[model samples]
Target: MTLATLALTWRHLPAAPPCPRPRVRTSEAVLLSVATLALLLGISQTTTWGWVDPRTLGLFAVGGLAMAGWVWLTLRHDEPLIDLRSAFRGAAAAPNITALLAGAGMYMGLTLLMVLVQVDTPSGWGLGQPVAVAGLMLVPYSAMSVLGSRISLWVGARISPGRVLPIGCALYLASTVQLALGHDHVWQALLSMALAGLGSGSTFATLPVLLVRAVPAGETSSALAFNQVLRYIGFSVGSAVGVTVLGLVSGPVPDEHGFVAAMAVNAGVWVLAIGVVVRAIAAR
Candidate 1:
């Protein structure tokens, strides 16, 4: 079904029942953060290398099993920090889809753009830099993300999260436009990245607010964790699109021109995201 129809349907779902919010222990929160960060780093880096020997694979398997055991032991107890029930049935499914699409749009957008920057030749507009050097070019974008995150945190404190999500959708649209109109050179790309950063910070940080409002207090963590999982799914799909599927299309084959094409697809996704958010707001 179309996103508009889904949003309309979601708006009509019965309000969720209230449940007690378990207080978070500080130690659990700290350990959770550290473990999550470490896990993310490990997962995000695996694609960089080609393969692993049997010994390395054996180590990975053992480590993963150990981590799983730790998590299970932690959550299986009474007053467990992780609530699994809420995750399965929070807000209507529309917002979940929105989260996934937005996440995919952000990751694919960056990866394809980076491809564009390094595809330079006289025939195309790329800067023709090596991947190592191109990595340096993204520093500004990362810096801007930090600034945007801080700003989003402030803005979220004052505004409804529902509003922030639409703003993110709009900013992503703006980034899409800037990249589509490539005549402006490097500044335009940088602007797109900054705009992207703002959108990313706004939408991601506040998504749980919507999730929380829709679910029982007891389900808060569970609902939010599901949302988090979807975001990672988006990230994975985006990587495949940017790194694999886009290349199969006829063009410069991962060069600037190909990147332009890939970004155009991402732009379309952004437009759909905008529609999803708008329909949601209107349905309310």
Candidate 2:
């Protein structure tokens, strides 16, 4: 199926016209890479190194300084790696911000759900399911996300493309709330995944469109790439935070309360994304 899809895409998709290659901003790229790596390391290792440990704090400080340097160099350079100024203006800014929040929320929910499923039933709220069963649970989410993508396109054509993001965020929010309130039953988890998939598809699909429309043709690739970077950072942060919260609440084995707390945080993130999306639309 994957091969066939790839073949079809290769055969049908139009080749992009060649454009002049921009000069590589080596320093900016290095700084950004250093910052991303340091921050992610610090976040992911919090459980092991402890938050206030010098190693963790050192990583955070390095990441922050690198990020600051990247911004400063970017602002001064005529042809920087990414056009931060243009990317943060108007509609473009909305999708980037939404991507960060939504990405974090989505990842947090997914990580928590996986852990919740595999947890031993003796924990009172756990399902004690095997890894295979837990993996199968994501099938609905994967299938529904494709359907949601198509649905968003249909809805966008009929109404406004801008509205699709908020709608998607609402669905994601609903799924998080559902998970927070109940997950004792397998059916409930499946339902939540389905809803989350739809929301993810809708928002993910719409973000690119909004971004493309907002940026100049020449900067499309860079803008999209930057948005993806933000999304990934959000994902890393979300997963780390979710695990941290669960660990903090309950030692090695997380309980119902821990799961609930993580989901609640995820839900709040989605709410914030929705508000940002709505505000962006209103501003326009």
Candidate 3:
């Protein structure tokens, strides 16, 4: 796949139009990288090291400081890694914030679904399915997401892309609620995945469109890249937090309550995302 991509790009990609070279913001880049890595590391290790451990606290502090430095430098620099001023404007900020929360919710749902099925039935909440079956359960999610993406395009054309966001978030919220309420039956799990996929598909597809429309043409790529970064950060944090919550609630084997708690958290995040997007649209 990598070679094919390379070959395709080499053969078919167009040359860039001549333009002045953009200056590299090396310090800002380094600070941003350090901040993201440190925060992710701190979150992931909290399950092993205990939240109060010196190492965990140190990482958190380092991440916070690095983030603060990055922001300060970005504000002062003529050509920073990211344009904080423009990015923070209502138009761009809404989609970015939505992406972060939606990403977290998406990962949390996936993790919980995978874990829920493989857990032994003896736990009184799991499906006791084999790993293969557990894996297959995600098929609906993948398939429905494609459909959802199409649906978002259709709906966006009729209404507006910004409005489409809340609809997607609402679907995700419903899926989480459904999963939280019932996951005992295999069909229930499958249904939840379907809904989640649809929601994710629509939400993810809409975010980029909204972001690009929000930013200047020259800054479009950078803005989109930053949104992706936030999304992945949310993914990392969500997966880690889901696992930690499960472990805390159900020990080595996850139980129904753990899944419920995780889903509840996921649902809460979606609710917040919906609110943010709606408010942004209203303000616009």
Candidate 4:
């Protein structure tokens, strides 16, 4: 779902021109497109990846290795299928930090959410959803990123998306806290999910707007793609942190309290992001 948002956001980004009749005729886009297809093929062929147990932690390691390969390859390209150079600390911290922090924080916070609902029967607060059903809960939120894209466009047509992004981030944080407070039924989950989606959706939409403002024209595509890569990295890290937190906590009946603890850790990200934006505006 988040993958879809990342794609949509990248699509909406103010793009750079294709190199004028490049000598090699192989640009970063072509390389990345091939890589994406390869990744998709790997995912689609997982069932056939036999010998290795599908449910084992080894799958996780395999996935990580795939990503590492992607990153490594991206860096190796002479023109870089996705430029890492632009992501340096050169620009104002607002865009740079906001992109990095939000990327990681969003992943971590969202990962925390899945566990909040999926903890075993012993955990009192869970919805006890099987893996499939639990996965479906995210469908609505996934749909919302498209909504976020629209919201960003509308907002961008007026004031800066920089202003809009913080607003979105705050709403997301509030949603996290509210969900932490607890839900008696699926509706609460739905509501919280919507709010959460709206917030994340908004950020996903707006960040590129912010990125374009902060980066130079030549580096736009690579910068934007890298921004997205950071987000994927964030999701992995966030999921891991959430799982780790669950292991350390008390058994069963994991309630609003558990979610809150996770949020407490995530809240620092928002604080740091807000500081970046604040300082950026102050410098302006």
Candidate 5:
């Protein structure tokens, strides 16, 4: 699937506009890389290392300080890796937040679903699906996401992009709710996955449009790049949160209650994303 998508994107790619490459800021890049690595490591090890462990705390502190320094350096430099100011304002901020939230919600959901399906049924929670069946169940989600993207494009032609964000968020919110309450049956699970795909596809389709509308033509690439960064950050944070939530309820393996609780929490993330996008629009 990945290879096919890559081939398709490569085939339809547009000719590049003539633009000089931006000069590298080695110091800023190095500092930011350190922060990202440390933060990711700290988060990943929270379960294994124990959250209160000095090593974990130290890594987080170092990462935070390095991130702060990197931000300061970028604002001070004339030719920084990215123009942070423009990217963090107006229409860009909402979609970026949405990207982050979407990242978090999507990853959390994927992890939850994978666990919910495969754990032993005797645990009173999982469906006890074989690994292949579990993978097959996700096919609807992948297919629906593509359809949802096209649907977003169609909807975008008729409505404001701001409207699209909420619509997308709402779909995922509904999906999460469905899974939280009605996931006893495979059909229900499939429906939740479909809603998730639609919701995600809507946001994914609209984000680039919002980003382009927010920035000048020259800064578009940088703005999108920054947005991508936020999405990855969201993914890391979501993975951490999912692990933490499940850990709190785990015994031998996570209980069914943990899966339900995690889905509920992720649903809240969707709500927060909706609020952020709405507030950003209001701020404009």
Candidate 6:
């Protein structure tokens, strides 16, 4: 499946355009990578070591300081890794922020679904589905994501792309609520995942365009790349948080209550993203 998808996109992929050379700042790059690695390590281990553990705390501290230095260096450097200035100001800021939150919610909710369907029913809440069946249930989600992107593009002709974000997020919000209420049946879980895919597809498709429109043509690529970094970090954090939540609530096996709680939290995240997008749209 992955190979076929890559083959399909290969022909349509655009050739890389030439641009002026950037002065590489090796130290800054290393520092930023350190920050990212530290953050990932800290978050990923939270399920094993509690959040208050000294190692976790120290990792976060180091990552924070490193990130601060990286930001400071970027602001002063002649050729920075990311064009943070343009991204943080004006219309760019709204979409970037939305991407961060929406990415987090999307991953968190999806991860929870994976766990909810497969965990052993020791706690009397899980369906205890086999791994293969649980994974197969997500096929509908991937399908809908593709369809949602096409729908977003079609709607773009009539409605502003920025306006589509809240609508997508609302779909996600609806899915989370539905999952939280009932995910015992295979159909229910698949439906919730489909809705999630729809939201994620539209949200991801619109974010790059928004960044492109907000920044100078020369800076657009770097700006979008930076936004992608934000999304990746958000996804990592969400994955770690979801695992931590479920682990904390699990005994010999995970509980359905944990899944419910996690879904509810994600629903709130969707609401937050929707509110931010809507407010940004209204302000414009």
Please name the candidate that would achieve the greatest lDDT relative to the true structure: 2
Q: For model 6, how does the per-residue alpha-carbon lDDT over 1-284 read when each residue is reduced to its tens digit?
A: 99998988897888668877777789888988999989878987777787999999999999999999999999996668887776777889888888888888988988898887887674567767999988887798899889888888778768898888788889888888998998778788999989988877888888887788888877887888778878988897787777777766664466877777777778888889988888888888
Model 1 superposed RMSD (Cα): 11.0
* Candidates 1 and 2, the one with greater lDDT: 2
| Model 5 agreement with the true structure over 1-284: per-residue lDDT tens digits | 99999999899988688889788889998988898888888977887887889999999999999999999999998878878877666667788878989889887887788777777756577777899978976788888889888999888889888888888889989998988998777788888889988888887888888898888887888788878878887887787787678768765577768777888889999999999988887777
For each candidate in turn, the TM-score is 0.64, 0.92, 0.91, 0.68, 0.89, 0.89
Give the Cα lDDT of each candidate: 0.67, 0.90, 0.89, 0.65, 0.84, 0.83
How accurate locally is residue 202 in candidate 4, as Cα lDDT from 0 to 100? 85
Worst ten in a row by lDDT for model 1? 42-51
* Higher-ranked by TM-score: 4 or 5: 5
In the predicted model 4, the residue pairs found to clash are: 108-238, 122-252, 123-252, 123-253, 124-253
Per-residue lDDT of candidate 4, residues 1-284 (tens digit): 99999999899987667777323325445555554444444433433452244543454555556556656766776665555555655453466667667766776666666665566544456676677766876887777767876886798789866678787777677766676676556666677677777888887788778788777776676677767755665555555555445544633445556567767777777677777776666666
Off by over 4 Å in 5: 1-21, 121-123, 250-252
Candidate 6 overall lDDT versus native: 0.83
| Residue 194 in model 6: lDDT | 92
Error of 4 at 35 (Å): 16
Name the lDDT value of residue 207 in candidate 6: 84
Model 2: residues >4 Å from true position, as ranges? 1-19, 121-123
Clash pairs, model 1 backbone: none
Clashes of each: 0, 0, 0, 5, 0, 0
Residue 208 lDDT (model 6): 83
- Candidate 5 root-mean-square deviation in Å: 2.6
Q: How many residue pairs of model 4 clash at the backbone?
A: 5
